[model samples]
Target: MNTTSQPSTADRAFNLSTWLVDRHVEEGRGDVVAIRCGGESHTYRDVLDHVERVATGLRAIGVRSEERVAMVMLDSVEFIATFLGALRIGAIPLLTNPLLPGRDLGVIIADSRARVLVISHERAASLDDIRAGASEIEHVITSDGWADFTASDEDGAAYDTWIDSPGFWLCTSGTTGMPKLAMHTHGDVKATFDTYATQVLGITANDRCFSVGPMFHAYGLGNSLTFPFAAGASTILEPTRPPTPQLVADIVTTEKPTLFFCIPTFLAALTNSDLPDDTFASVRYGVSAAESLPAETFTRFLERFGVTILDGIGSTEMLHIFVSNTPDAHRPGTTGRAVPGYEARVVDPDGNDVADDEPGQLVMRGESSASGYWCRSAQSRATFEGEWTRTGDLYTRSADGFLTYLGRSDDMLRVGGEWVSPAEVEGTLIEHASVLEAAVVGERDSSDIVRPIAFVIAAPGATVDDEELTAWCRDRLAGYKRPKRYEIVTELPKTATGKIQRYKLRR
Candidate 1:
């Protein structure tokens, strides 16, 4: 097992930066390259140097312990350094999605009451509006600001923050409303690394990690940042916030990563794109989360690139994947099993365990689960119940351990006296040769009955024929499960991490 700095209940210093950034250098792996981004390589020693600079920079700007340091930076060397740096000096780094609009960003800045915002040059374009709304911002650190901050000689003794102190905050996609912060402690990072990254991936220093999912998302946080860093492995940071298939293809071909982390939507795009069969030739495994991977997408990508995708479900509250498909137990359509150190149960609305094969809300109890959402008392209580975190996703567990995704609790459509899983319908729709991506939503018909409606994005050269698509679904899905109407769209609305925003389609 990979060794990491363990946490304790005693009042001891347990900064995540020491474990993820400084430990490698302390252990004589300083020469090992920790990160590769924007055509530059940073060794563990170099990363530590960057961490020190960020720490000193934050100090120079009077950032004290437990302060919120909002980071709106792109996926680059500075992102990891800044995140670790904040942890090093006992500040809470709030990671925001760079693709979020100025208004949402402004709201987050105000909500968190972040005094310092470390942003990229491109994202700083709307600084005026964001700053105007969030007067709490005392300092705005950019590239030029970073250069000066890092170059400065200002330094301080590393703060000995408690192990249970809020280490970082990840913004929930705000699918329901404005984004809320999921507060996780320093120990949470190590917990995810040990359970999912260690037991599942079995990553070693020789492995190279590349993820298309932006670091802001929970899956990507574990996949690209914590997983590799804790194992002393190298991670590839793609600066392109929303990476295109071709762009990702080029990175895989060039970076030659051993482990590839991506979402199902982008994976489908890569499979459907005209990219070469060996586009993912160097990837030994593809880790997928954020949403369920359709069986067709799983099979197609595997047949085309010889890369097996381990599709799993994780949440912001849970910190990372609590259940997943491992190498030995991978099933194309099922979420394999509860990850080591985590326990999962499918329970009904009343929190009673449903019989196997009965769909219910998934609740996970794990050490990596976030403490709770910051400042949302009612929501925090509702989502995080004592030791368990309710995922709000619908799933059916088999008699044994295999679990199948049904869809979100709200996403299950009641149609024609039977429940229809949008995932099941979407899976069938994407199986059609012409369909690239599909989203199924409920719509009331003329008879005031809820029916599934399909919105689809066509494959590269294929045209969406209503009849042909209907025929494809007709053969596969049940009469009630089939989409009542099909609407061809240019693109499905998605979050920055590529989770399909079904609410938008519903709207």
Candidate 2:
């Protein structure tokens, strides 16, 4: 097992805030564009100046060490400045999706006891009710006047002595109920870049990173923000929600990024779009995570864009992708071998290793794994055991070391004493020409036995009937593995990160 201990004092002395901010200025790259948004570009020097001003503003507002500052703002230079500024002043920043409903946002704010809520003007209008419910939020900072608030010339507190303290919190994409806050230290941030970003992805200073995922999520936090800055590379930030296929294509064409970070849904959409072959001409690598990329999506994207999308699996707890397919050694259907500095295994419920090719829970240990969930002791203990974090994902490992993602362990189905992976069935369903997306859930039949049911979204201008889809699956899947029924839907319910909420489908 690869166990990570608390960072030594010497290790903690190298603060990520300094590495990402001051180092670039010293390297004479201050004038280079660090972030490009809609019509505005911020140089490294410009970003560092904002970070210092925001840090001073945060301290002036009485935000202290280890205080939680909840942020619900769009992706922009201001958002990055606020996050790094909180770190500079020894406060922990909790990044939250701005589009979340008021009730959900209230739950997060109340649970984290955030001293301040940083939000955009559009989102702030609807938060009056949420703020009323969240007693811990003492102040609200809107983006309309965000720049005015950070007009201070002070550099705030020096973080050199407090780098070991908790730095940030990411809310887990709870498959169940309310999301839990996962705590990470500054050391954890550096470790993610060293292991996953530098070692696995091999990002360099020349790479221009573009991401389709929101920075609030773990995947984006690591790939789009942390990794690029750690490598001294520039990133393109979109100020709105994840873009559509045409918009993404346009951004790639205009930005000419070398590294494109995305997820399966976006890949599928791009594959089905009318983008020309040269859309991704400048992109050296495309990466996918947050969910498994279907083999069909993988192949279609390769054929259309002539660039491989490396699929991987990760969680907010792990900070970033621990097991992944690198640019050179990617397999079409499997998330490749474990990255350097991580250990992984497929284990049964008893914690014993399962035979290769047998489906089992994936447990892993790595340096970048979060300390644990904040304020949820019982849940934290259940998830973070000593060195190993039991990822709720189920997978099967091949003899050669590639890992094939099945489905969430809770989403696994036992039908007629046989196991069924919803992802497998869903992947097969999407192979049909008319299906744009598919989700599977286990439902109880009239005989009180579990059965697989499928929800499908048809392709544009394509008509799909229940009988035809069922017959199509009958030829590909085993008799017992086939879905008992198929329902055509206009769209699949998805989280902000683009992951299908199968639990909602079950409900």
Q: Return the TM-score for each candidate structure.
A: 0.97, 0.96
- Give me the displacement of residue 177 in model 2, in angstroms: 2.2
Give per-residue CA lDDT, model 2, range 167-189, as digits (tens): 89999885666789999988888
lDDT of each: 0.88, 0.86
Cα deviation of 397, candidate 1, in Å: 0.5
Best by lDDT: 1
lDDT of 1 by residue, 167-231 (tens): 99999876655778999999898888888888998889999999988887788888788988999
Q: Candidate 2: global Cα-lDDT? A: 0.86
Off-target runs (Cα >4 Å) in candidate 1 are 1-12
The residue pairs found clashing in candidate 1 are none
lDDT of 1 at 338: 99
The whole-model C-alpha lDDT of candidate 1 against the native structure comes to: 0.88
